[model samples]
Target: MQIREATAADWPAIWPFFHRIVAAGETFTFPTGLGEEEGRDWWLLAEPDRTVVAVDGAGTVLGTAKMNRNHMGNAAHIASASYMVDPTHTGQGVGRSLCEYSLEWARGAGYRAMQFNAVVATNSNAVRLYESLGFEVVGTLPEGFHHPVHGYVGLHVMYRLL
Candidate 1:
């Protein structure tokens, strides 16, 4: 899969996977019923924030990610990112590449570290991916996320110094 910065025109391809992921209400905190326009606005980002996609040679979007400052001025040195891989394309390393690219992007942007604020603990695949990428579970907020099928689940705050 090839990773590249996403252009506005790519939104259409991204929407299908994005919509499914958000609607599942299993990992992301986005409103379970978030609509198209709002989803576009939230993911497209602006300025210092960046968005990217992983595509196959045929130009199919296999996954996507967005990166930005973890917080405002006081916490700007730390970076934050979110990722989504097409369910049909899961286990093909698309999400891994996105995470790797996001880290490199943050480093190049002079970020001191990267922090994932609310990783649903039940998402073992994601937790393992972050750990493999050098992130540590610094803390877990008890019952922080309401998983659609898993009831209340802990949310991990994973972090790593760049």
Candidate 2:
């Protein structure tokens, strides 16, 4: 697979995975019914921030990631990012590649560290992946997320110094 910066035209392709992941309520914290317009504005980075896509050899978008400053002004040295791999393409290393790409983007953007503010604790696969990638669970907010099926679950704040 290949990773590349995304263009606005890629949103249509990204919406499929974005919709499925958010609706599943298993990982990301986006509203289950988050509308396309809102998703577009949230995922498409026009400037300052960066957005990317992981595509297969045949050019099918397998996953996506977005990276930006974790905070404003004095806090801008840290970066924040989110990743989503197409469910149909899960377990094929798409998520891993997107994550690695996001880190590279963060480093190139001059971030001193990367922080993930709300990782669903029950999403063990993602939590494991993040850990394997060198992110540590800095803290957990008890009963922080309302998983559609798992009910209340802790959300973890993960971080890694770049």
- Superposed on all Cα atoms, model 1 deviates from the true structure by an RMSD in Å of 0.7
Tell me the TM-score of each prediction against the true structure. 0.98, 0.97
Give a tens-digit lDDT track for model 1, residues 31-65: 99999999999998887899999999999999999
User: For candidate 2, what is the lDDT?
Assistant: 0.91
Clashes of each: 0, 0
Runs with alpha carbons beyond 4 Å of true place in candidate 2: none
Q: Say which candidate scores most in lDDT.
A: 1
